[model samples]
Target: MAQVASLFTLFTHHAKTFRDLVYSLRNSLLKTGVFTNEKVAEQQVVSVINFDIHLRRDADGHRYIERITECVPVEQEAGYPETFRHKTTTEEKMTAFMETMLEYFRRSTDRPLYVARNVIEYRDGSYVAVHPLSERSRKEIAACLAGPDQAAFEAFLAVHWGDSDEN
Candidate 1:
């Protein structure tokens, strides 16, 4: 079988708030092999480990993900290398990354978190991972936007998508 990158969707019931979830995920990912040596930047709604991986929460607060991506080197090699520089192959690295995440989630909370894995695709000259937001999540988000707490809702949007002026 051909090896490919994997993206995981994480669902947690222990997270009472979005901030709590982001914090937990950041700490957990830092302990993983893939992110241990990398610089992890934690924001209000997203945490990025270098440029190779990112952990973020969906807008509706119904989905979370730790995305592991393949980084292309700026200086391209002329030809295929004779052997891998690292002892572990790409597949092995991905396996370890997945295992570490699963173990962390298992031990972090009493409530079981649903984890779904999907292989990333390179289509039409772009990398793509299909993560369709559910209709329920969409309705919930719309309700929030239409509700009285407009200030809080706008704050949430600013944190995730940045301020409108900046955009």
Candidate 2:
């Protein structure tokens, strides 16, 4: 079947943020038998998703975008730190392992699949940037563009990310 297309997909949902939206999506898909395994379904959602934007309204019914959040995948780049690998003593290894666990616990959320960061936020009657896009997302977005737009968006990303390598 043929269907109309847009530059990006859109869905009107009651999710308050990226985290909420992902959790809701997983639950809905599982409950309806769209997917059976919780872990697999969550990974599917997070792996394909990039950002979620929330909108807000005032008493007068004027609507504005509240925030734009990116769904950050679990970063495994930490790998094996030299210091951690060099720990030869049992006590040292125990402490290192404990520290790693502590760090994980600190960032753990109710839905620990992804960490949502607000890349853009509305504040004081204006929209402002809060965080920059991850390099992976930047590259993915760039790959979807062409011609002048590709060049222009790349420039914006270079400046926004504050790193030429990111674009």
Give the candidate number with the greatest TM-score.
2
lDDT of 2 at 76: 38
Supply the global lDDT for candidate 1: 0.40
Off by over 4 Å in 1: 1-10, 37-167
Runs of candidate 2 with Cα error greater than 4 angstroms are 1-8, 76-111, 158-161, 164-167
Best by lDDT: 2
- lDDT of residue 100 for candidate 1: 63
Give lDDT: candidate 2, residue 115: 74
* RMSD to truth, every model: 19.5, 4.9
What range of 10 consecutive residues in model 2 has the weakest lDDT sum? 1-10
For every model shown, what is its TM-score relative to the native structure? 0.22, 0.69
- Of candidate 1, the 10-residue stretch with the lowest lDDT total is 43-52
Clashing pairs in 2: none
Candidate 2 residue lDDT tens string, 1-167? 01135445667789876767888887977998979998667877786567787889989999999998888887534543335556999899888877876666655433366778888899998878677887778777878988788899878865765564321
